[model samples]
Target chain A: MTGPGRPAAVTGIGLAVSGLGTPDDLLQPDGAEEAFDPATGLTGRAMRHKDRASRFALRAAADALRDAGLLTGATFAGPASRTCVVVSTNFGNLDSVCTFADTIAEDSVLGLSPLGLPHTSSNSVAGWLAIEYGLRGPNLTVCNGGTGGLDALFWARAMIAADRADVALVVGVEPDTAPVARLVGHRPRLDGAAAVVLESVPHRRSRGAPPRAVITACTHGAALPDAVRAVRGTDRQPVGLWLTPAGPRPGDAASSWCATTRDLTARLGECSGALGVLQCVAGVSYLDASGPGAVLATSADGPDHTAVAALLLTAPGQAS
Target chain B: MSCVITGMGAVAAVGGGPEQIFTALCAGTSGLTKLRAFDLNRYRAHHAYEIDDRTGPGRDEPLRATRWLVDAVEQACADGGLTPAARVPVLLGTTLREQRSVELWWRGEGEVSAADLHFGPALRRRFGFTRTYTFANACAATLYALGLATDLLDLGMADAVVVAGTDAITESAFGTLDRVQNRTPEALRPFDRARAGMLMGEGASAVVVRRDGDGDRPALARIRGVSMNCDAYHPTAPDPAGIAAAMHAAHTRAGLGPDEIDLVMLHGSGTELNDAAEATALHAVFGDAAARPLMTAIKSMTGHTLGGSGLLSLIVAVLSLHRGVVPPIAGLTDPADEAAGLRLVSGTAATAPLRTAQVDAFGFGGINAVAVVERS
Candidate 1:
């Protein structure tokens, strides 16, 4: 819906993490507990079989929709068929799969629950979000390591750019269960979900909805800095802030071109797949409080950092 | 922008490569036999379409599906004559990713990590790819990835892209199916009046897609259009309306009418609801056309290959368009009442002059995807 130079707008943002309730909470470090219940905010039927990661996703999705003024009570008031859902997570369903396999191993085929079968699928989170909200547009799930969150956002932007949908709901979530902890060892794990609502400029304007920030570019490259450079291409417009997975260090190269750099992982436990969306959410909160400025969010795929992705966003009225 | 398929590779229960699998299908060879991947002493279902350990990556491998994935990608690159320096972006799709290895690890027999559950690092290490995406959209994942690959090419993101899917049978999936089926089916028989349920299979498939005239490589087929959507209705039940909408959208985007399609690779999982729902959707889309497309279900021989089934079907569709041969849905005798008006290939392979063909794939959680491929 945006022209070549025009940018898509982020109308709303939502987050659901242990001991944290909002995006602004990330700025102030608070001790997070090991367990957080997501059932308090979830309403409606057929949610009994939803896995932990899916529950976090549903809660975050609901909050995002409400923030966007597209949802009230338990019903969505927007154009359901014109909205799409994309989810990103690497080990969201590992616990469920392991439990199901245990049931089969111990009790044979008879012990398998019919309802439990669907939860083993990695896309169950996206599917449940769609079924709960009746979003019939394109549905996708990404599990491509650390850059997965950025990849999800890129696809959402791509869908809107190609006119496949007018609005896109992008979610990133991960579960820290017994099996996941055993597999990942002592690495920082994500225990909740983060979501962003992206809408075309025309669609946002037609609905008279205010934009928190506008996304100018999203891309994938071989490295995080290169990805940011690719998106910022040939432009001398200085970046106001850089939100990265790793914390900012002294004499950081990003400091030369960006006003400030904030470490997402330092504030919000290493989120892995949720890092990108959380970065965008943090960027939006910063721009909302700091006035017109540009923010660059970047993440890498694995320890090798061979694959990376970046997203560039600016305040509502700032030039891209 | 027009995206064309420059190369394809596949590894199914019946054979190891696209050409060998196609030839075996044409000869009515089925891979269904006693389930040997695991102990079946307490299970009701005794048979499945499984790849032989000797022919596959061996039974002791940590992750059999990853090996298959590597082989398929290597074959695809070789077929396309693409060097490792090309650095093609990869888009991978799967339902159960490395779950078999996880199952082994759970049983205290193998070692598996969080990294083993994904394919990005392995792919990059093997092919030096800098950009790769993994889509876990259930059985329809491959088609969903294919659609995104086309989008990447259309946007000029890369000169070439590799769309792939891989998965192995897991104890969880097999047990779930075994408990859900009313009666354990001895063999998968799609579209038959006596169809019972689906049998699980394992394998991997890949296709290299490039913009038309991107290189000197010969194009195997042109990907006209790909459409994906979610039913948002039920988790396991296939929605006829959603399937029909995807098919209609694919045809509309391809700039072709329903009559233009000469063949259709049906998502025939041999399940009662899936077959009936697919047929209903097909009838709704075609609507009394004089010459509707000839429908074929390779799962009759390959078994339901889960995640990789969609790309496997696309590869077969391309071969059919090139060779003018349509493999029959083996074991199907009498068509069901829901499939009465449709023309289904059965008993033996059919010969036809095909130009345009469509591949259908639907997954758990109501995901649906359809792709139209044609000989340009």
Candidate 2:
């Protein structure tokens, strides 16, 4: 197992749950909410150019960066040289892709939108973020299913620990469309997106950043043996906040810390790939107000099951 | 903690499984054929390395691409002597999802499944796998999967991780190639003077990576090092600096020098930009040296499988290292002016016992992945 690197600081966040608009919205998840708009500040040609998924991603990144005080006036003032960009997306801009393909099919090969083809790639959102912010370190785009969001978090932390980057911007995004909705089985009221900024403890201290949550430890295992051991060292807990696609899939290794495992399926309906990050956001907010929370994300409903567990520890003097 | 390739499987345009594909490569057989999967009458290019299903009545239960994935895994499991549990971790890469719905969904013929968009979860359910990863970095997809497999094995997350990649030629990709970019001419002839472009190929290839102590079977090769990095340059075109950085990182991680690379697997997509970009990156890494490790190109034989291309080349590399031969580049008249500086393997298979082999794949989205394997 790799050494748990210096605690990466989650200093900023941009949440886009369907019913709830922000992390504050997550705290009071009453079935009532306002219309979701990630394209608020981002306008003009860039907005016109990006598809829904990319727009959602850009909005989150911009908001998280703003929350982190990395913005200088209207631009990001953080050290772009070392800030890594990671975007976790499931389908990518499949709507534009389908439409692009439709044009080619209805017309010919030349019947293509040169502007649309690049955005059709699975990594387009990540690439656009990198280009938008000029982040040059490692522009990683992961495409795992429900765990992709947490996997991006795990990877971002590892990079920080390995001295791969000084700062990381990770966004978990999934846009809903007729095609994507049919694939994942449920459509959400709004496309989901969440962004969190992770800075090295050293970088955070240097910036005198006021961090919200400290990721004490984050890991994934093929077997549950290591996780049980890791949990034994944590505060005694119930299923504090369970984050499942529906009522937990059969093979999910429900954490010992969960109190009331929250069912996202019925509340927010089902989201495509943004579920993991949304869960992480909720976990962070829960830890901030409630107590220590564990996110148990499972993806073995088919047969061969794999579970990724992430622990959110309240900062020193957080709460009981 | 050494990572070894105990078993490998493939369903390529040239042949099925590694042994057959290796044999076909040695025979210099071309698999490029007329595009009959559907029909391409109006297009200027009417051929690709597409697999034609002439034997079986079109059965549509599980996806055809997913079937290839499972078959390749079965072959790898058999070779490794592994009865993988119900939850073996799987990592797959491909540019396009199983295209069952590409036409069907568009024309109101069939509905799209989770398999078409998010293939990992669908395959994970189909195979009953616990942990699964899908890397879609165009041509470099499987190499990315291979690198992640090494990480899972190194971290002891799983004793064995399935690293596979597959792509079925569809109107989405073929349409793009036929009209947008890298238009194919007959077949792929990469790094050659008479290069036309790359033909879209359909394939699914897998490698079983196990911790050194997982099995008693002899390892085919050892993964000494692997690196994945993106070119922050353009979306489609590759940045030489980005490609070189990835190659250098792979070398450093492998603890090998440029000279240690006994055999080099070129990304050679048979396109002008891809081939030129690859050559520039290689020149930066290896420089002008006559006695550099002998180089070989495989897409000419296997066709560019997009997401499956890198893994197909990797499967070929493992076979080459294990069998001690580099397959010839078919349909070659002369080397391109830019590639003239690089050593090309042609005419017949070269039998040079190689110690270290470095396989490279540069995908469309500017993702460059490199892996170095040594004869185990």
Candidate 3:
């Protein structure tokens, strides 16, 4: 295990959305449609047929792959060369799972749809990516509520450090689904997917690739004071995003805002897994000369909370 | 880095814990029985090694499989002399999460709310574990859980990690199995020439893991390597060549010639296609050793636990190390016609000093996981 100094570099990024179904369509002001859904409480045109999570994941994964130049045939040394996929979600296709459950309840003897069972699995997206990209390496799907995205990224970094995979595709995708909307007492809002291609710094520098974001540290737990103190001494002005029900407190807005999965879920309706991607988009949107802003994603259980804080620093000239 | 098995606990049809299951296995008594747990009037296949409600901690109300999982984890922690307050990160693997809820809903009883069904928080709450992770990838969930646990311990993420897996066959799951045409009507006979399909079983198993420090259980066996690969080649059927993700995992992790392995625990769904593909994969990985390693399929006895099958097989391998005996294949009357020189343990258990073993767990969506365990 290396120290906090060794950063987990983001070499590539990808995204797909309801308004923007593909990588090129994403972020285009006019091309994207207004994604809505009544069952999920989404108010925009959602992706057709494809589950919200898969669409979001494919979009983010494609963008990250393209950004890293991996799609362009660029290769890096270290774990990046043997890329793995880690996708995390809060509610993995609960709509589909519940649908299957409903079918079984209806007729015990009736045959269930083959397609539905496969889609209902939590790891369906990861399995799809592995098959779509032929990534026969380590593939995992983690479900830890809102903190899933941060956890996925942290796991990708650890996989790289452990020399398990050379390049890691860390994707967080949540889609607006009816069951998810009911569970959180709100519609899915701005359901999105974000992909970050992580690799070792040495490999990128050696390949003369365009510099990407440098992830300084990612720590998770209940104690925010200690994490806050660790990054306070840094030169960059970190912007924190909290996605909790209450939103960020008034004073916490200086560097931290209440940008949580619950907030994203409410806005995006059924998109519960892609909340992290929306947070990443929020983090990327806030990037400026303030250097790469620190994004902290937190979720709580009773008195305990799990916070994943990452220092997002863009390349020297690429700060936009 | 070597991965040690500090503690193990299992709940199965024949018994509630490891000792009971092992005793039944030693006696060559099958756990397969008529499905009295649930009314199977609509379905044809009624045989399953069902878990009695009173067997676990909470008996009054039919507890969710997650409760049994929590009990197993508690047993493992108690066996390892660790506490939940120690903050041991937990990894839970299961194919069906809160599936019993569907049955309850079918009966017009109270529905299992989303909060209770969601795995991550429910597990944390059940065990009072703070840092926890869960995987729901078909049959490969538990093996993948073990693989992730090993990686976490090796990376020093936590000094100790608890890996548990559970899957209780409910009426809803049985209906799905019946729909898929994968459920066997009578018994599970892995590699048997006349084998039809699989017998669904339910249970929970947990293993406590800690770094190999100065004083650890003498390192009973080392989890030398683990690999999880997706076939993505097919949704249900495995790749015909079987030279895909799972083969790579076995070869990559063990870094051993096929001859080095002493035994093989197969995914063995009792279907012709699955067994043939597995045999082919074994041939690719072991080459000559494919014929040499004492291949055994425990599913014939324990039934398929889906997510928990991988870890359950691994526990059996660990028991093989402890007892120095390889359990027999319960129902293999005739080997597959295309079977090569592969040695299938049948009828009686075999005594052998098992140094290295490979356990395989393949799932629906082309997910394949392999783990290599060895005597330290």
Candidate 4:
């Protein structure tokens, strides 16, 4: 229920990508890690038990929770029933599914590894995250192709708005299986995951958590006007423009009116599942210097007859 | 605002349409047959509740699941007096996407084409839908999709939304069943003494939901509320507490108390774990209440359709509420202790003044969901 002044506040961020180092490293020229492993942040039997995709999501989820201070001792404040997990992805654990299929084809179905059967689902990562963190709330996996990330964020916001959950964790993970990832036109090195923590304005303030920014609006469309109304008015100046890597560049006027364009795909590599959320987080960081920001993403559904668009507006949490 | 089920269609092992399915269930007809869609030499448990969904890739069918989906959507839209010209969105749920398509992809014969990804966009282009979505949350996916559809209608996002689900038995699923060793060599039985395992099942179902103020369209039943949550305990097993929590949440959201429910359709996959977990969940909620709703399991006839099972149960529940009869389990004997204090329909259909009913579904990955409906 975001209004003129009220918006959902972001308090935490976590990331796992092909690159090494840290979240900021993803923006650097040589950000892609030579051999970044999803098992780095996990431990014990879990690391051994899960697939690379689940491992990637687990690392990112842990980082996001830690950033939001939910991992340490935030449980005492909110009931597990008031917390939820929403995962966004286009193709679920393709690697494991393919492998499981191989085992079935080669060996007898009874000879296949039973433990590996669980990871073959589209929501396995979300289920594992819930089990690891004990977020026993509504678990959803939004898989509407490339638009999944923004849709997941919007879904989380809707959950909070509907009073379904007091706290929401939104994560997008895309683990590359060369064949499957290539279908979405992602590069081999684009294997990664990103997560954001969302809460109500009052909830953030009550927890004394410093706000990163306020997400004012998120909307999807079959199409949109060339110029957005969110960027109009002198007082409503935008700080930067965030665009999906494959998205077209904005007009000179729109670009100059805001900060430099932050091409998410360029910086993080073109990942279909993780691109939308990555762009949102990058916009938040870019807007930190000045004020608000806007991110626009579009995908061709079928000829020009059908198209999909996701637009998000963010404003500074602290008043000028 | 409330949502109502204006139209529903189901393609199960029993038959298509609520009346056909209801009649078959009443007559104790089971749909178990030898798996024929794919080569079953790679697995044990030769029997599966499978349909000869051979319409696909060519020969006017286009896709193996298209015929079942067509039957369901056509029935649902006709029942609701809805038309493709309205450009409504279709929200579909399935445990596994079209396995045939994926199998080819794995064998390097093809890739995950647009048609293989989701039924929504494809249906739109073919049937003139406004939008299409495919939810892949496994067993409880359809119930989840139902919840989302209800949310859309409640929010006025769409005047009428078509919630559908379809999945066909394939070599991969049968292989999984064989690996898990959760299939009954005896028979599909729920709450029975010899309820050893589940019988793999697959089919399709569709329902048309309209907003409360969408004119006097004569809804089949009023969709009171929907609740979906996860166990977070195990990947393939459901926690009874999680199941109870989902039911309680749905009740709270519908503004109804536990006593209001008079009938329930279970996830009962005919497996020991699923049945035991569901029974524990039921006991957790009812706690020996005098007016506890009679619990019924339809998997005895339809096997377990996985994601499609919940929506099938929903169609059956609607027909039961409308017809005033709870379809028997088809075949049941030697009730287990889990049947203690709870009425388990056996042999013949039971008649009751069922005003409120709930359809519960659980899936692999600890997915759990419930939908409550009241007589309109």
DockQ of each: 0.58, 0.36, 0.36, 0.43
Best by DockQ: 1
* Cα interface RMSD of each candidate: 2.6, 3.5, 3.3, 3.1
| Per-model tally of clashing residue pairs | 0, 17, 47, 2
Q: For candidate 2 chain A, which ten residues in a row score worst on lDDT?
A: A296-305
| Clashing pairs in model 4, backbone N/Cα/C closer than 3 A | A19-A33, B120-B132
Tens-digit per-residue lDDT, A240-264, candidate 1: 8777776323246666788877777
**Model 4 off-target regions past 4 Å?**
A1-6, A29-44, A73-78, A181-189, A224-239, A247-262, A267-270, A289-292, A297-305, A318-320, B55-63, B84-89, B108-111, B182-186
Report the candidate with higher TM-score, 2 versus 4.
Answer: 4
Q: lDDT of all the models against the reference?
A: 0.84, 0.70, 0.65, 0.71
Q: Which DockQ value does candidate 4 get? A: 0.43
Q: Which residue runs does candidate 2 get wrong by more than 4 Å?
A: A1-7, A16-20, A30-42, A69-84, A137-139, A158-167, A181-189, A199-208, A216-240, A249-267, A289-320, B54-62, B99-103, B120-127, B182-184
Which one wins on lDDT? 1
Scoring model 3 with DockQ, what do you get?
A: 0.36
Model 1, residue B144: distance off in Å is 0.9
- Chain B TM-score against the true chain B, each candidate: 0.97, 0.93, 0.92, 0.93
In model 4 chain A, the worst 10-residue window by lDDT is A225-234
lDDT of 2 by residue, A35-84 (tens): 45544544566567777777778777887898888988657788875788
Superior by lDDT: candidate 1 or candidate 2: 1
- State the lDDT of candidate 4 residue by residue for A1-320, as single tens digits: 11223367777788877655556555555645454555454455656678776777877777777887777653323456778888877665666656666777787686677777676566787888788777777788766665667767777776676666778888888776754654555454367788888887778778787777666665544433322333232355454554544544455656565565556666555465566676666555555544445544333243232434354546544631
lDDT leaderboard ranking: 1, 4, 2, 3
